[model samples]
Target chain A: MPKLLEISKPFIVLVEGKDDAEMLYSLTHSMGMPKDEFQVLQYGGKQKFPSFLKQITNFPEFEMVTKLAIFRDADENSQSAFQSIEHHLKSSDLIPQDSVPTHSGEVKKSDSGFAVGIYITPDCSNKGALETLLLDSLTSEMKSEIETYVTQAEKSLSTDRARDKYKNSTKSRTYAYSALFENASFHDTFNKRLWDWSHPTFNQLKTFLQAF
Target chain B: MPLVQSVHFSNYRNFTDFTMDGLQRINLIVGDSNVGKTGLLEGLVTLWGNEEQFKALPNTFRMSYGDYTTSLDSFWSWLHPQRNHSLTMILRSTDIDNLMRAVRYEDHVRYDRDSVERSLQKTPYKINILPIGIGNYEFQVDLFNQLANTKNGKESLVSSLQVIEPRLKGLDYLKLPSSNHAMVYADVDLDYKIPTTQFGHGFTRSMEMLSNLILSGSDIMIADEIENGIHYSALGSVWKAIIDYAVKNDVQVFATTHSRECIAAAHEAMSEQENYELNVIRLQNRKGEVVAINHNKEDIETAFDLGLPLR
Candidate 1:
């Protein structure tokens, strides 16, 4: 386990959709990363952001989280939810007013070394810009099939939207999109071709950590 | 299988007769207010609890028509003081699944002198409810030991509770709180703790169904209105636990509820469970006699359309 001097590797509280949490944990563990290193909490859906926050605050480990990340879909209410958290924290004097990020993907650090980030993106591009870019290159027939399938699965789309907004990263969205499409017929279609644009997000995550 | 699957007798207060027939893994009894939802459970309690236990109405508190009826009046029967009851449970042999193959009531014969100088004696009623052969047989133990013998050892009853727990292997320790003496196996042990007094109305009524089901090893146990006071969120888990345990122990259960959550939980359980047969009985009152409307896949949609709440 990587340690920051006497400081433990910060607990990255990832409160995302249920399937997203499951996939994240699975992906993390598959890469030899211990699940316990970052508590991957499931939010069920973005409708429960307030309750999720309240529940997480109740847990004893809430204060120990050196990095508090809010990953949700950029639904109609995502901006309000992000602002709610920032407002609540600012009012509570937990985070400096200036430190609260104004836009998605922008990192803001608190006085106590605690950091917060927001991920808000369009629903269609939830698999991130890269995966969406890859999907863009697909045949019109394939695009229509994906859209039609997604349109029918509106419930799953809402959940995917919440996740996309939370991670605030097109890269994470691409991962999610991959997961969603992994079982679909399009997986083989883009299986070999999409890596050029999509592989770098995970590689960037590794690089970012190594540099830090 | 129960010939009369569910019975709802009210207005007479203590003279409720809620019985059912041909019980399955999951049975739903639906009826209007005062139609004997709780009354049905009372009958099962009486049948499973034992004749002696039922006779000593003072000792064994009974719930009738969704309300606890503690004081015994000449409501059930005037001829027999013992039969002045609220409910009676008649179960089919096949529904039992040979889990508790034999259940023989202990002899309860006591002589008492009436004010008229007439000698009154308690008669021992012996009936083998289980089949002649099959099932993991154990000694037919009296749950209400005191009813049989005033000086019945508490340890003996406690030992019986312990004896029954291991036979039902799927029981998780987390779900069941343990006893100091032993794990309570019989219906008596489970009901002993249920605060059935009118004072503990909420506690009494809430746990009454679960308490009776656990204590009485009746294969086809019936309970009306499962989520009385328990939160709807918690009711799902409680029902799941009970259903899971029942399915594993080969116990068929019939529970009626007006709450949509309870119906949803039962429906969800049915969808997940393939082996269980879930039948919803909607009682239609015509004049004075009540007729049950059973819903199956063929007419479930129609039944739902008729406001039967078939989930």
Candidate 2:
């Protein structure tokens, strides 16, 4: 179900799901941002952006919203994902009707004078997702071990459909790594510090957030 | 169509230029105190209600008889924003000829009706505003008499009330030998008839609300703080009854609430229907001015589950 965003901070971030929300929550804290400076909202998924954005725009508390940021997966194409977020923002009249921001991490002024920013995961140029970003932050030894375990089990126990579905997915690989520690969720990896946040790989995302 | 399809307010009470469009049949207004939820209802009454309903605004505002005396100029100026005599309070609605407006300037108020309404100034339709902070006992006889006249409506009321209290069997309107006024009696699980006053306010208030809604024959019903008399537990059943009756009778309801339970119960009840018709309008104070934010069925459900601060 599409859930409404609870506005508790002047600056807000709209993420795709619980994993994305949890990822950003701890990631921002790792960057030394105050816990209350930004409110991370799980809008269910990228598919629910329309209804969820409608809820946010119609919420009375949104009057106090001075800044907004959208986090999505680069997933096949980073530019297209940024454009999609821009379309939804314009459709809900959150931004100027015809105005478009030039870059992925650029913070632009909304129609109501609030700052709006968009960031696609795994860097602005990569054709990957948050899982790819997470995997990049892990030690090469741990990454190789998790990958070997998933590959070794896939040939024996995986169905044809599962193989075809996850042929290029980092989600299964990341999940396998999280499972190594008693099968915690991908979001739980953040709290466990399974991913190194200080890595230069997270510089772009951190910059986008700090701009707000 | 609902009586007021959309509304616009300018210099009306706490609102300077607030407009809430896409009005639904069932609207529940939520806001912090002094956000002008009552003022919105009064604006509706000013546009759709009859002369009696207009005159009853002071009482609906919870003002005592002394506070509303004609000698007090402050009472009249208080309707304007900041009590500024220079500013005129204007309320416009889409129902009447695309431009039904009530302008309140100083102590003089005027409502111009288009050709569509032959009796707009003294409309036959009543707003049926059940006020708060006042005893509803004054209308027991009148409401009971109206309810008794319609057998089908009365049966619907009984069945709906049973959802809240299963023991309720029937309702009786009996007049005491000495007094001319009559009172409502509940023939519940007991062998004898007992006055509804003997029951809890939840039962009595629910019974009164449904009875007044069905019997009053008002196209619009404005209830202030609907959850006042009812307990939190019975909120779901009461909402179910209200929504059912409102939809079946084509009556538009505008109610205000301070309880989160009331909001959740309303969402639960409306979501049960195949075609959801619930709209939760929340008013908030942004800086010194107030604004209206309208939420549709799915929007309200999302806010409810997420525990969004709507009120």
Candidate 3:
């Protein structure tokens, strides 16, 4: 249920679910930023993003919002995910008719004078989701160990059984990597034990959020 | 119509320094439990506290928090915890100069020396009616009589009540043979007339709200937990009647609610109206100081769309 009172924040970031919101909240806190400076709204899933945008655009509180950023997972295709959001933005008249930027991760000003940024996660260059991004952020040594473990597991099973069990290389790697952190849920793997702001792996996300 | 454009207060209750701007005709106050949403309303009431209004403060408090004590000492405890500090609130409107200041000791409370003089301006329609929460049955009867006294007032009351209970035909005062005072009765379904209490909680509450809106002649109406006893489905119509009556009578309304349905209903109703202005004020305690965030009509609509939790 929506709250009756809207909490005031200059910037609002829309993510896919509570896990994404919690991760970003942890990251923001680790970077010495106050939680009240920005708000992270979970849209439940990527499919609800367009409806969420329409609602906020129609809302009176969004007028006071200076910046809005949409964060979504690339999943199977980064370009397609980016295009989907771009189409929604253009249709809503949030961006100029001819100014839909070609880059997947660039900030554009809406017609209403609010800054909007779109980011497709697990690195815009890779075809993956937030879990993919988390996997990539692991230390190189841990990454190699997880990959080797997944390979060993794949060889132990028949090719068809392995295919049935693993689904894809990303899922397999995620499972192996998750095992290292006491088999934390995909949502809980981004805790302080596994994430550090000082690590070079977080440079991109840190830079993107700091723009607000 | 006079809108309370802003309100500023210092050392009042849980608020150290608080200022809320861009108040509109209908403002809904919302926040987490115990974040001082009621305190803010009380602060507004205190700002308009005259001798007569001050005398009724205890009843208002009793209605809101169920504290039965009539002494002003209980009211003084609402001041910020810092001892010897004075509570000050300044209300800014287009044409009203309203302020309230009061200091309290362990057992006695007194208005600041200059507060009484500063609050004496005869601003037009400066009446403040604090309904607190539940409307008293006896008070509702008085208001009904006052509304019935004016031409077409009874018809207006019946018309508004029909939105909730279509069977309600009219309202009348009944003088019981056993008692001296009269009680309110609703004429429902053409022939069967029942005491107002038999019409259920919602009917009584709606009657109280409509009668008060008509008879209070108040410039400002403060309703804490305005959604109480009102059905979620009827919220839109109830708000419409409230807004319509408020606008026609030049009354500014401040209401609080923890229910999202109430807020959404108010937003939908306000949007349907041509020129009504509405704001949702969210009170929050950030780092020990109370902060008021004003969400205008558009903002509230967006919040509804995105399922943002305001409480």
Candidate 4:
């Protein structure tokens, strides 16, 4: 939790929503770090990313924040998503010039003396969101079974019905993940309690956050 | 200007050992209920060395509880939950020789400035203390009468009254023939004059507050729940008047508020004035120990921008 105070922190991570904030919070706890050492702020939504960036950078806390990381969903394309965040950073003058990370999980330090990192959901390998990333965390045996169930479920419905029901690839993947948690709500699947941080799928995100 | 730049307290109320530095001209103490916001104000009033305020402590507590039967021992019970401990407060200011200390003993409390004990016999030194709380109509009316007798006092009172009620034309005290005490009256029209009671709490509270500020005359003002009885719309102008008067008279103000509108209005008022400092101190109960989170102007402004609830 990021408190509104004059105290300085070594770094702060900005996420798009509550689920992302909770997951990252649990991840840091599992890594044996004190909760107060770093702060995680929920910036409300993807569209609010720019405004939040501008605010935090201009805020008095900016002097104390040595590193600032942003985490958002890749949605359909990781490159475009990364570009969108880069534009905000550039426009806010957090970074002097626009430069893409040569490799995934690379950290970029802006001209403002703050280390900046951008992590898109689904672990950089997939062109999807957090639900897509969680689906990748499933065991190979469980993955096969879920894929079979989703394929059969799609076939059972009419094409128009399937298109309306599933909508995007991430939606079906989210349903598949939800089914594993006793048919929990869509948000419950992303709960920190449901996450298995040891899974290889989260290694990239873990490394990137730990670098801060 | 004698501004209290920092305060440290030990074994006082909820605070076992708490210290806050970098206080400004106008400090708005805000936090959750029962976080010792009022206790901090009481501690300042105690240290500011006014016998009237010191003696009024018991009455203030009784008024808060709405029980006049409350004992003075109950007031002393605020000296830390642990027994046999002295409550100590150290207030430092910009002037090197202006530091003051207040200590509460088992039997009595002592106030000292520059290592000299403050005598109650003295003509209540230049540091005038005005504490504005609920239900102080009689005291306010007396002060109002004193101010009305002075050449400029009447004009100042009318001007301050018009801040809350623009139709307020004149203000005077009406002494009743049946009783020794006098009641406050507001002249809103030429043919009609209404008692202060009829004008409502907002008007009376505003009049009491502004009168006290003007009469305080280059001293510290302590107001608990400063926004009480005032409309949200009038907060901006009221704050502007407070800041302007405080600046002109070299009066330092310490007030508490649970209203976001009040804090916002104060920030707006302070920002418009040049070279005036506003600090918002947030008290938090952390693991049974009170902590003061001090925010400078820039921090408070940013907190407002982000919609962080300082209260």
Candidate 5:
């Protein structure tokens, strides 16, 4: 759902990877935002944020861009992720180079309506990833059932080497939930609208999308 | 350190008030077609060259795809925005003291000063333009003749040729009685001295360009579509020769390319050098103005790793 090479829209939303981009594509659409209002692009990984930021600013369409949104996972530290985006944003040749917003769901607008913003997943302040947000969106009964299935699946493994992959992995838990629906892919779960897009857990992320 | 630290162009072929600073010794310009790649090279040659060069090479430096209008009196006439013919084109670089300004009147071009000309004459370097097909075979023979006059120039040519063809034993210029004209030949350790052109386009292309860099004794070498004739397998070797010769002689080289392999080869070649002095300058046409985006060594390496749309 997310475009890779060219940026046809005036407003760009940079995601961490392809799955994030594809998920945000339907998420933003479900949030009542106009389809042509923005474009979501993947930078492959968070370590390449500076390189991607430096390169996109050189595009001819960048001059016409009025807003930039960075969506990366919190992973370990949310503040650090936000700071990384802020550092590269200031270094870029974006119009009205200024400070980025420090808090999530807040937008800093330039005098020319050219603003740059950031939103770290999952829940903006948590030390987790997009899968954490997806897992929280499930109903209480469904969440417990999926967690038990993932725990027992880890016990069935032959060795701790194979079991280590499931330990502290919200990704494996999310995949287990998606596996219930005909073995859909990571993005297919997002594309097929299998997840509860209108869940209250997405309120902060929805608010962040409104800033662009 | 860069020789020409910065350059500002005022009304030079649709590039109105564009400044490209942070120039390195070796720069590769890339962009969409007709975005002033060749114009940047030509503008530099005119800004740093003398009146003799302008008279002798008015249209030779242009790319084959540029708008070649015969109605214009000379290349200088088109330097003006919309060809008004009344404005003076001013080119300023950090290395030179005076601004090189020129105006075209009724039939010819006029300059106010020749400081850049005198400065070039005093130095041991000049400007050489190598467009696609550099020159004819006879022209290559002439270059070989010039380079042979100096010490080790002949051996250098043979060894550099060995980069693409290891069997090459020697290079010579001969005008045999049976031949219609004089030309250059290669000794590929075969039975007879094979004509260089008889080898292949890649070999002849590499021979002409590698020799031109050494034989012309140019301080600045401008090439267009550097990967035109050479094959993909030999791109790395050709790039090594260009980088080595350019660094050894402190020559400022500007080459344009549309091939990713060419860009990678140039980047790879510079990586082996002691110091990294390569920059990829991409010109983008926004609205009506030409904008330049310079990617240094780190940026280029990132582009390669991420598959960025740098070209």
Candidate 6:
């Protein structure tokens, strides 16, 4: 019989919640690497970011995590969400793309060693559109809640001021989730799932470890 | 050259136990006459005699404490009229491994039949000669004891003549041609064989000092009252020669005296020369105790200008 391939690498997975941590754990277990070869940790939430940042910065393998993936729920308050999380990175001079000035020096002066991204369940077009999309879900109760939430988010996005605020809130949520995920991997496994839907690539997480 | 680095005594005189340190070729013992200055020198002479290799003198001479009384028991009556007398010494030498050894009294026998022993108020007199070098060859014969008020008590007072080796008997004596009379040897026994007693005290003292210098190999020479009979003109030359010998042989000197000329002589010897380190320990007798008043070259000059007695 042909032998099974083995992974002899130490990896860590960072996530925001125990649920996310368990989810990442399950994903990597099914992936090529054994669950034992990687570590996993959850930062709990954004409130712990500063302490987590300090704790992670001291790791000798801090720069080795190959990938630092972020996962956050994009609620309709973009600007508020950005405000809640942007201070730490701002002080570090990492101006987010949305906040950056067009001047070339601005980016050079403000870029920190981190990236930002957001995940949002796209908004329906009309008043009854969310309710119809909800019908496609297997759990009718969850579908209804999603429908209600999406409707509220869409209404909040209707005005430009509200829309910017919602976008910022969603962006902060994603940044917070990513920060949690990275901090978790710093404390535990590196090649584990980052969110319920996405796993941190071994190569990406390995970058944080500095050694493959 | 006759510097005494240190002196130790154990029953040699009134010093039941005494030591002298920071010695020089000239040492001043300037207290009341009875405070045991000459007695100390007598003890040193006895110690020198005990060492046969350096047999500067014969072991037959035992040191006796020179005080007013003829008997040891009556010494208290003559001096303090209250306290009994006993003395001990421990001399230190860099050349000797056992740096200190005691000089003690060795002959004591109890006789109840004797009339004096029966009437005695205190314990019978006992003299012990402490063993030096642990029973190795006449080590126990260094001390001579004089006990009082006993019929059998033998008065064994040996002369200080043993300070130097006994001359090959009769070698020091010469028969005069006229009547074949024999003349005693002098320190400077040149052609005329001038008896040391007939020679100038300075010459005789220098000769004696030179003989000691050759014998002791002492780094420190301490002469108490170095000006005893020294001539003023020869004083400077004598000091210079002594210092020269000390420097060449790695010796130091401590001398004490009440003579102003002697102080000037030492100053002249030291000031006009280099190489030999010099200091004077002026002694001040307060009440019944003697304490040193130390002075360096500058201090000595200042004190001299003030007409203060260095002794």
Which candidate comes out best when scored by DockQ?
5
Candidate 5, position B21, lDDT: 77
Lowest summed lDDT window (length 10), candidate 3 chain A: A93-102
Candidate 3 is scored at a TM of: 0.56
How far out, in Å, is residue A83 in model 2?
Answer: 3.0
Tens digit of per-residue lDDT, candidate 2, span B92-186: 76663454545343454545533325535535345667656533786765676677788677677787678677888888788867548677777
Root-mean-square deviation of every model: 22.0, 4.9, 12.3, 12.1, 4.6, 37.8
- TM-score, second chain, candidate 1: 0.47
2 against 4, candidate with superior DockQ: 2
Candidate lDDT scores, in order, read: 0.42, 0.74, 0.70, 0.68, 0.76, 0.39
Q: Write the per-residue lDDT of candidate 3 for residues A1-212, one digit (tens) a residue.
A: 42433536868888988778878888888888898888887765766676666545544465577777788999889999999888887887433444444566777664656677778887766788877777767788988888788777666776786567665477668766666676486557666445555767677887777765
What lDDT tens digits, residue by residue, belong to model 5 across residues A42-65? 787887778778788778777878
| Candidate 4 lDDT over residue span B165-261, tens digit each | 6788887777767548677777888685677888665556666667766765646777788887678887887787777667766777788889888
Q: Which ten residues in a row have the lowest lDDT in candidate 5 chain B?
A: B98-107
Q: Can you list each candidate's DockQ?
A: 0.01, 0.31, 0.12, 0.06, 0.32, 0.00
Worst 10 residues of 2 chain A by lDDT: A93-102
Candidate 5 docks with a DockQ of 0.32
CAPRI accuracy category, model 3: incorrect
Better of 1 and 6 by DockQ: 1
Greater-lDDT candidate between 4 and 6: 4
- TM-score on alpha carbons, each prediction: 0.33, 0.81, 0.56, 0.56, 0.83, 0.32
The best candidate by TM-score is 5
| CAPRI docking class of candidate 2 | acceptable
lDDT of 4 by residue, A144-210 (tens): 8877777777666768865676643656765766766785766665553676778888888889987
Q: Rank the candidate models, highest DockQ first.
A: 5, 2, 3, 4, 1, 6
Docking outcome class, model 6: incorrect
